[model samples]
Target: MKRRKNIKTVIYHGSIWIIGLLMIYPIFWTIASSLKPENEIFRNSASLIPSIFKWENYAQGWQGFGGLSFSTFFLNSGFVTTMVVIGTLFSSALVAFGFARVKFRFRTPLFVCMIITLMLPSQVTLIPQYILFHNLGWVNTYMPLIVPAFIGGTPFFIFLMIQFIRGIPHELDEAAYMDGCSTFGIFWRVILPLTTPALATVAIFSFYWTWDDFMTPLIYLNDTKLYTVALGLQMFSDPSSVSAWGPMFAMSVASILPQLLIFMFFQKYLVEGITAGGVKG
Candidate 1:
C-alpha cells in the first residue's frame, strides 16, 4: 500500500513538472527568439541560442519601422493601462463593498444583473458602442478606452472582490459599531484593511488586461501618435514587402516585461488574496 502511494505521488509530481514546462516554453521561446539575428529566425537547423545576439533589434524597434516611433506607443500604452488599473480597482472595490455590506432593495437582483453582463460577448456590443463613441466625438481618443473603467467596466472583478469581502466575519462590523464607528468608518477602517490581498489581485489582473488589450485601442486610436504597443507592433509589417521579424520579436519581449515585474513583486499578495477569498462564506 505504501509503495502504491509513493508511486502515485511520483507520477503526480512528474506530471506537474511537465505541465509547468509546457506553459513556460512559449515565453522562453519568445525571449530567446528576440535575441536571434534576422538570418537565423527561420533557419532549418537553428538552435534556441543565437550564434550572434542582435541587441540592435530592440533599438531599431524602439525607433520605428519607417514612420512612427515605438517610444510614443509605449508611453500611450502605459498611460492608458495605468488609468484602467486605477479605475477598475477603485470602482470595483466600491461597488463590491456595496453589494457585500449594504442592505438595499433589489440588491440581489442588481448583483445578478451585473454578473449577467459577464456572459455577453464584447463582439455583440462592438458596433453599437463604436457608433455611440463616434457620435460623442470620442472615437479617435483615449476616452473611449479608459472612461468605461471608471463605471465598473469589469463585472468579474467586482464579483471576485464581493466574494472576498463576504468571507470576512460580520462580527468585525458589529465590534466596530460597538466602538462608535459609523458604517463608512467601519468600511474604511475595518473592511478595506482586511481586503488588501484581494485588492492586490484585482489590481494585477486589471493591469495585465489593459496592457494587453489590442482591439479597443486599435478601434479608438486613429492618429499614429496615439498608438499603444499592441497597435504599434503592426508597424513592423510592410504590406508591400516582408515584415521585420527581429524588431517585432524584440518589441513583444519588451512589452511583456512590465507585467512580469508586477507579478513578481506582488506574487505573495496575489496568492494570499486568492486563497483567502476561497474560504467558505
Candidate 2:
C-alpha cells in the first residue's frame, strides 16, 4: 500500500510539472523571440539564445512607428480598463444583491432573461450597438467602451456574484435585522463585508477582461491619441511595409507586465474566494 501511494504521488507530481511546462512554453518562446534580432527571428539555423542581445527594441517600441508613442496607448488602456472594472464591480455587485436578497414577482424570469443574454454572441449585437453609438456621436470616444459597464452590462459578473451571495446564510440577515439593520444597512454592513472574497474575484476578472479588450477599442477609437495597447500593437504591422519584429515583441512584453503584477498580487484572494463560496453553501 505504501509503495502504491508513493508511485501515485510521483505520477501526479510529474503530470503537474509537464502541465506547467506546457503552459509556460509559449511565454518563454515569446521572451526568447523578443531578444532575437529581426534577421534571426525566422532564421532556419538560429539558436534559441541570440548571439547578441538587442535591448534597444524596448526603447524603439516605446517610441512606436513614426511619431506615435506607446505611452499614449498605455494611458488610454489604463484609463478605459480602470473605469470598466470599477463600473462593472459596483454595478454588478449592487444588482446581484438585489437579485440575491430582494424579492420580486418577476425575479426569476428577469434573471433567466439576463442569463439568456449571456447565450447571445456579441457578434450578433455588434453592428446594432455600433450604429447606436455612431448615432449618439460616441464612435470616436471612450464613452462607448466605458459607459455601458455602469449600466449592469456584464451579466456574467452579476450571475457569479448572485451565486456567491445566495450561499450566504439568511440567518445572518435575520440576526442583523434583530439588531435594527435595514435592507441597505444589512447589505452594506453585513453582506458586503462577508462577501469580500467574491468581490475580489469579480474585480480581478473584470480588470483582466477590460484591460485586454481589443475589438471594442479598435472600433470606437479613431483618433491616434485614443489608441489602446491592442490597437497600438497593430501600428507595428503593415502590409506594404516590413514589420518590426523586435520592437513589437518588446511592446508585447511591456503590455503583459501590469496584468502579471496584478494577478500575482491578487491570486491568493481568488482561491480563498472560491473556497469560501463553495463551503458557505
Candidate 3:
C-alpha cells in the first residue's frame, strides 16, 4: 500500500511540474527573445540563452512613429482600462444586487434575456453596435470603447456578482432594513462589503480584458495619437514588408509586466473569490 501511494504521489507531482513549465515556457521565450539582437534572434532561435543582449530594443521601441512616444500609448491604454474597470464594477454590482435581492414582475424574464445574451457571440451584435455608436457620434472616439461599460457592463461580470450576492444570507439584508436602510443603502452597506473577494475578481478580469483588447480600439480609434499599447505593438509590424522583430518582442515583454504585477498582488483575493464562488454554487 505504501509503495503504491508513493508511486501515485510521484506521478501526480511530476505531471503538475511538467504542465506548469509548459504553460510558462511561452512567457520565458518572449523575454529571452526581447534580450536577443535582431540578427541573433533567428540565428540562435533554437537556443533559449542569447549570445548578445540588445538593451537598445526597448529604447528604439519607445521612440514611436510620428514623434509620439510609446508612453502615449501606455497612458491611453491606462485611461481606458481605468474607466472600464470603474464602470463595470459600479454598474454590474447595482444590476446584480437588484436581480439577487429585489422582487418584481417580469424580473425573471428580464434576467433570463440578459443571461441569454451571454450565449450570443459578440460578433453577432458588432454591426448593430457600430451603427448605433455611429449615429450617436461616438465613432473615432474612446466613447465607443468606454460608454457601454457604464450602461450595463458584460454579462459574465453581472452573472458572477449575482452568484456572489446570492451566497450572502438574507438575514443580513433584513437586519439592515430594520435599521432603516433603503434598498440602495442595503446594497451599499451590507452586500457589497461581504462580496469583497468576488468584486476583486471582477476588477482583475475587467482590467485584463480592457487592457488586452485590440479589436475594439482598432475599430473605434482612428488617430495615431489615441492608439493604445495593443495598437502600439502592431505599429511595429508591416505585413507587406519588413517588421521590427526585436522591438516588438521588447514591447511585448514590457506590456506583460503590468498585468503580471496586478495578478501577483491580487492572487490571494482571486483564488479566494473563485474558490468561494465555486463552493457556494
Best by lDDT: 3
Q: Can you write out model 3's per-residue Cα lDDT over 173-232, one digit (the tens) per residue?
A: 999999999998999999999988788898998899899999999988888899999987
Q: In TM-score terms, which candidate is top? A: 3
Ten residues in a row with the worst lDDT in model 1? 272-281
Error of 2 at 165 (Å): 0.8
For every model shown, the clashing-pair count is 0, 0, 0
Per-residue lDDT of 1-281 in model 1, one digit per residue for the tens? Answer: 99999999999999999999889978877887788888888883235788888899888777775567888888999999889988988898889989999999999999889878978899998999999999999978999999999999888788888988998999999999999999889888999999887888988888888988888988888887888988887655545533667877788888889889988898886676556545532
Model 1's TM-score against the true structure: 0.87
Q: TM-scores across all candidates? A: 0.87, 0.88, 0.92
RMSD of each: 2.9, 2.9, 2.2
lDDT of 3: 0.86
Whole-model Cα lDDT of every candidate shown, in order: 0.84, 0.84, 0.86
Model 1: residues with Cα > 4 Å off, grouped in runs: 1-19, 238-243, 268-281
Least accurate 10 contiguous residues by lDDT in model 2: 272-281
